[model samples]
Target: MLIETMSIVRDIPNLNQLSKQRLDWLLAIKQQDFNTLAAMCYQSHVIPYAMIRQLRLPKSNHYEKMLPSYIIQQVNIKNITEKDQVWLLSNFDALVTTQECIIFCEELINTFNKGRTPKLILQLIQDKCLPTQNETYWYSLQEKTKDILKKQFMISSYYELTAISRILSHENTELDLGFEDHERRQIHSRTMFWSNYSSRFNRVRALLPNEIYRYIETKLKRLSPQIECFDQDGNQEQSEVFIFELSNIIVVEFLRGELSETRFFKNTEWNAKRLFDDKRLSSAAIREMSQMEVHDHLSTWQYFCEKLLRQKLQVKPNDNLPYFKGLPPAVNTYDAKIGLPKPAHNFLSERALKLERWVELFWSAEFKTSKYGHQSGLQLKSNLYLSKALIAKQLDNYEEYELFIKKAANQGNPEAMWQLGKSMLLNRKSDAKIRKYGEEWIGKAASFGHVEAVELATRFKLAFIPYKVSSSITNNDETDIKTKNMEQEKAANEGDLDAMYQLGRRSLLKKGDLLSDRLVAERWIAKAAILGHEDALKLAIKFKLPFVKKK
Candidate 1:
């Protein structure tokens, strides 16, 4: 049955493979359709049997990183036709399908944009898989695939697949309509979260599928019995059925209660295990998790932003589309930037409290230290600042919040500078007082590689926002000049788009007795402009400069 199932998939169009043994197995199998082969591969223990017989686990825990071995089993090229091979090559990428609202894998229907043959397609996917390390070569393969999808296939659909891949990889798939660049970063962060989360679960002998969300949803809907438990001290606390729904993931958290520890089993051949196991979680961790849950609300905000941005401009994300450079800002400083705080809505506030309770329970510090201790000084100061800022925001005290921002910014926190910049830039009046602080905040944040800061500074041509420049004496001092120069140099090395624009403007306008090489400054600014800096775009159009845009 296994051999017959494998054979059908081997013959499926766009399923690239060739091995004599696999061909023999295919000839032996009775299955003839791609769907049947896929079903057999999924339902039977064929792949698991192959893994046990043919492969050894790597020294490290590679189970979580493992791929389905059906792809790795030996195959024969003699039976595969040239046309069949071409079809396989054309549809080499994976596709996601749904059966009765349950997600499953299906043969990807390729629209051959890359012009690569089936043989080449096999080589590409193979190249993406390393002999040893799993993280060895992901981005490069993703980039190559993205290029092909953009130039040849339907770009939009390709992006949807990419997004699906992210969810499969258990990465955050927050789609941001307002800020694509900002949201793309969260995807990487989500990948990190999954890696860490899986590693933690693996230590306790808990077997997890690659896609936890989909698996959990399917299992619960099928009435697969799973047990949940809480960890307290050493002796087993209790366990209960992990009854959850497919709609929302809130079921995962609904499992806390008192029950006797006992063995339980269901229709599926599986053993019950403790949800958290013997792992001793801390309160600090719980707090951080709670904070993250709060932040997850940003996903909805991101989706809305994507819709708004796409409608305002003819931009489609899947086309490997670079952001527009010279297009007049549809979203300007005047746009409403804030989202409603969860505490404002009663329903949201209830959920927030539950998440917060879990966080505080898991992350409570076991010990406390004296405030006067030198080791605790920095921690104390930062905490004080954080507490004050939180209070100010809670009371809707913008003035106090602004002061806290200045204090933190002066102490060199990029996040503080970013907050300050946002506040001043959004204010209606735009007072001299606010402008001075805002420019200072923007430059400081930009110098440190803050994304929003870079955006703001480049949009407005402010060289150095006049601030309380920390110094021994007055603003005219040489030390201040040296510091500013060093800051600019550092920012330039870090590829600050606004810094380049500033350099170009200063070079072109040569104010004071200060002089810089015109050619070098022009080169820097032109580079920035070419890379989609708004100021650079405006300057390029103004001076009628000629330069090709870098991909």
Candidate 2:
């Protein structure tokens, strides 16, 4: 019955960027005052059909397959002729309670028998109850009928039923029951016992053996339908002595669940120390210490002692037993090198030449350390350069980007150094810094075999080429002029402070389509501050810039 309704699409903050064409179409409907509402499609940048199709009354012409609006919103839907309602009730289990309330239980049962909508059977079983004839009628019977319903219809022993009762009660209606005095007491005790049993059983499942579930199933079968009761003599009695024998099997199952297959440990935390502190297990230990004898994976003596404790007292587990005492100490016998490291061999090989220096520097020290780790340093510097470079490039301020690149590279940052040299050469300024630092940078980078710098140097006729500029660049006028003026300065005329300031702040604001670079961003911001750009100066003061703030 599942059907795809809407495809996930681009992010749309609101309805603002919905295409003009789509908007115009929707506006036409709005102006006509049709029963239409326009909103962004759930999980899409585009609008869905303008009409609220689900709210439309079902017509012979309407497609049966289209999802109803109420259904899409997961609301309880009851819109149809009585005959149609009865037919639907007979075919779908999701509407079982709705059918029962509407006096169509026979139809619902027929639907269940036909095997249509089998997935909804569990939901129906869990929510089964009396029908809601009228709210006023139920209110009149609140005191009188509440008792009768609690005894007959609300006696389910299942956990899901108990949870559903709490939910139904909040809506202030009864399916078949109200909270009667004895039933209230029964519910309190049942909830307590159920919570306790579930908690311990879950913990046991987490710690126990896989095969032990079979043993438990066999044991549960052997016991009386009623697990515990008192006889006329007021002695706490059991139909079988099997409960006493269950400890070894339960403990085995618990340990297996914790150490092996993970299916049993679902939604439970497994801890050895907290399992020891349980009072029930302590009492059981005192009793079973002399008699029961069974043994398995007690690699640690602590585990053995805890197992023995459980056997002696025949302790019935409760909710609090599994709360952890603390973290277990590392097992000295277990090898730490069981799992393979990440950054696969293929991935490393592909980037080995480009990432050689970064790899060495990043791995030189343990990643997790108390003080400034190399990994932390690299992460911080990489982010910084990327942001600055992006901003400077966006503002067309290549000079500032060059400075930021130098600072990042001097800190052993290959990416930053590569960016700095690349920006200087590309912008065609090629000043002394480009020659002095650029040559040294390209050499250091190529030594480590950084592919990006090598590729650029090989293709461009710059004085600082790590290897020969490619054959294509040697004959080209554009590259030849660049090579000849590889050390030209681009400054302004003397006394023209505005032009001088602009020259100093050339790449302060990047222009055109380029990605953000932190180094470039910082450089532009810094250059503008040096020229007394008010906003830039304030930013410098705020961030406590390394050199300019003091000045």
Candidate 3:
């Protein structure tokens, strides 16, 4: 009855393609009739082979004993698809005896050599099948894999290196071949070690002999004059210092040459042409040579040159070089005594050290302040101090930040003034005198055309109006107040909207009966609103007055 049912379903297109003999084999496999399949295997291997390829057999070990014989007898290695091979390899432990599995793996290796099988099959054989075997078996498979990779490397073209690299660099497990350690070392080597070739070939480079490394170095040196054979010592610290010194010299020379050639420096007023031309200029002269506009350019050039030098020298960038002593030793060393101030040197990173060195070298305050016009000197000094203030802030050195920012502000740096003002104002617990000082600095910054400071000053001015009015009323005698009110009333009667708004605002602050004050304030604001004063109009609306503006 089941056979009859299968026959009905077998008329579908997939089953329709099979011949009657194959159809009978498929039906037998579905029915789990191993005895019939064994009998069918005796007649011809076709039905057994077709069953293995087309049918999804049960994976239980019950059929394990029977399936290996069918597979050995029915399947031909050259005729099966790689998918079929993978499946067979995956279940090879159950499908074949240990000896037969070895033979199957050898066949798969031969298939791989002929480029007919993927490396995954070999990986599966190595990872899944061989690990449980005895030591001899495991070592034998590892040796075979190693030999295959070595032979491939010897003959592999540039394009074929990736395939070999993948086979060697399995993520799940490292292949026991000699290349893994070498690949790792190459991975952690200076990026310049593989600078001659694409980084994609790093694994391949590890496979290269010393002769190839020498050849690459020779070629690199021949191509690039700046590149030197500095890697022999393998002291990365020394190499870093060498490169740093070289880059600094190059930057200094390049900047000097640029300044000497610049037409701006040749002007009679600057008198800087001779200063730039001196080969043995003092450090003071060097700092004087730098202008505010060239600071960014100098930084960019130094970075680019340093990177290029490191790449050429086959050295990695070492941020933690204890050997580098270009600058004087930091005197901020700690003392063990309790209650003494701790030094900030421990908190300064390598970047902060370099920033300090840069400020000391090129941006120091030793320049002639009156040589290149007073304003230019002050502007340059302000920028340099601002740079120092930013670095100090980054290091959380509040004292240094305040000191440098004050210097910059005294030099008329608007940004520094604004920053100082904002910092002072942010300290809400400060006394009124400090607050007023902060507000005065903000006003100064606004006068210097700082945009944010301008907006902030307008808000501060409006917010301080009531305070100013109340303070004046409190400080002045009744005679003085009466005279001020009379002058304000006289100005308001002449249609001065500012005077009208002030009068209205002053009435609202008079500290009397609330109803009378509001009524008096509303009348003055309404009169001002009639004259198209924006603030008076807003105040009138806020008071809920019934006044309309004139067209």
Candidate 4:
């Protein structure tokens, strides 16, 4: 009779819904009949929690798989045992659906509020469930859980802020907007978001209460001392990167109007009078000064400045700005004479002056301590000089621009060499001697593997020799040239675009039969063009190679 009943129950379509026969069959199975009960549960597609507990069935992998469905379908949160809750929490990834996980997390939080162990809830948050196709819903759930953790002091405010900043950064789809129209719209939206502080503040207050705001503010206020501690404890480099990101957030908030000038200034002063005295320093300068490490930090600051400048000037993302390209704009144009409008001009001027002061401060310290022995100090000095030169060019201060560029170039800064060389070559009234000097500078820059300088040198038929190559090896010069050509040929065959371009350029520059040289140059340059080398593509088009059709 029991076997006949089990067969009947198996034929039913909705055995997952508990019925009288299913319940009776489960009860009728003796405690020793564990296999029979398990079989019934498996066939029914349900496992009643009470029956499993009473029968002392082991929480096997099979049971764990079935448990999620049972919890979602039948278990009462209030009556669920701690052991079962632990099992459910531990196997959260086993939940068949995101909806099921969401339901379980909400219930767990409710349980947490009603005197359950906080550690369990915290652990659940730490082991976040796998995300689903619905990224928006998943990110929302993550933020909600993090907020709960923040409020309960399970996580630090700094941790929460970092998480929030990361989320915000991901939300900006600047890179994903591939089309010009979409990019413009995104930039406009970003501009609006940054310009409207009141709306931003209101949204923040809506999501996080005033107390949380005050807590974050207090933590930020105390960050300076903590950074100093990090420095003293030999984590200076790490601390400097941290301060760069932190100050970035603070400055962004101030620009957005979420933070007042006083609060922003207080948080970023870094005990530097040049930053705050008479408000001479721009926000970017102040932030730059607050950092301890000089390496790569200037590049970071420059990138940040570009973002801000794009927004302020409403410049399209792809608009090739001369400032960033290390080339000053045409003489006396709107950009060259005054690279920025009045407001941007004032900002950049302040920033340039502040950087100048930074170089002076470092020089003074080095002189006092006799610490000029380190290569890093000299590198830092060169980088600072280069930065100052770029700003001076933007501000149209030609004398200061030349002064700083020469200083950096003298220190073997390749970029400064390229810039100074390009400036000299582009000068309308440059004498033949000046042009020769400029070509030498460009050749030096090319030896340093400067891409643009190499392209420029190639166009001018200059030899691609390394700056360190000894001129006294007159007897072996031809042999060296042959060896270098062989190496370049090997690299080109191995698919190096730069090598291909160099070989093509060398072929074009050769004093040989024009027809044969043209074919050789076209063959190598065309290969590079097919591989997406920009200069190679241009050169290929200029040569009118048969494979390259005119647009």
The C-alpha local distance difference test score for the whole of candidate 3 amounts to 0.47
Candidate 1 off by > 4 Å: 1-344, 350-514, 538-551
Model 2: how far residue 236 lies from native, Å: 46
lDDT of 3 at 131: 26
| lDDT, candidate 2, 1-551, per-residue tens | 11121112222335444443344333434353221222222222111321223323223212221222222222113332334343233334332244223232322333333233233432342244332221211222222233343343342222322232232223232222333343333323323323323323311211112232233334231222212221223221111111211222233211111111001101111112223233233212222222123322211222223323344434344323442121133321211222112223444344333333332333332132222222246645654554455434433456766566666676656666676656555556678876666666665554333545554444453234233223443345545445433312122222222233333222322223134444554555566567555555654554455435425
Each model's C-alpha lDDT? 0.38, 0.34, 0.47, 0.47
Off by over 4 Å in 3: 1-354, 362-375, 462-551
Clashes of each: 25, 48, 0, 0
Which candidate do you rate higher for lDDT, 2 or 3?
3
Ranked by TM-score from best down, the candidates are: 4, 1, 3, 2
Question: Candidate 1's C-alpha lDDT?
Answer: 0.38
Error of 3 at 95 (Å): 30
**Model 3 root-mean-square deviation:** 24.7
Tens-digit lDDT track of model 4 for 273-319: 33323222333333333332231112123333433434432222222
Alpha-carbon error at 308 in model 3, in Å? Answer: 25
Error of 2 at 125 (Å): 31
lDDT of 3 by residue, 1-551 (tens): 76567776666665443355566665766777666665555444333444545444434445435554444333354566555554555445443455656555554554456554445565654553342222323323434543464354332212222222222333321333333453432222212221212212211111222332344344221212221232332221111100111111112221121121111111111222223233333333433443322222221122322333344333333333332111124521212222113224543554466566666654443344323332456867797798789767756778999999999988988889899988888897878888888888887776665646755776556222221223333333545557768976876777667677778865553345378777877788898888787777876675577898989
Candidate achieving higher lDDT, 3 or 4? 4
lDDT leader: 4
**TM-score per candidate, in order?**
0.30, 0.19, 0.27, 0.37
- When sorted by lDDT, best at the front, the candidate numbers are 4, 3, 1, 2
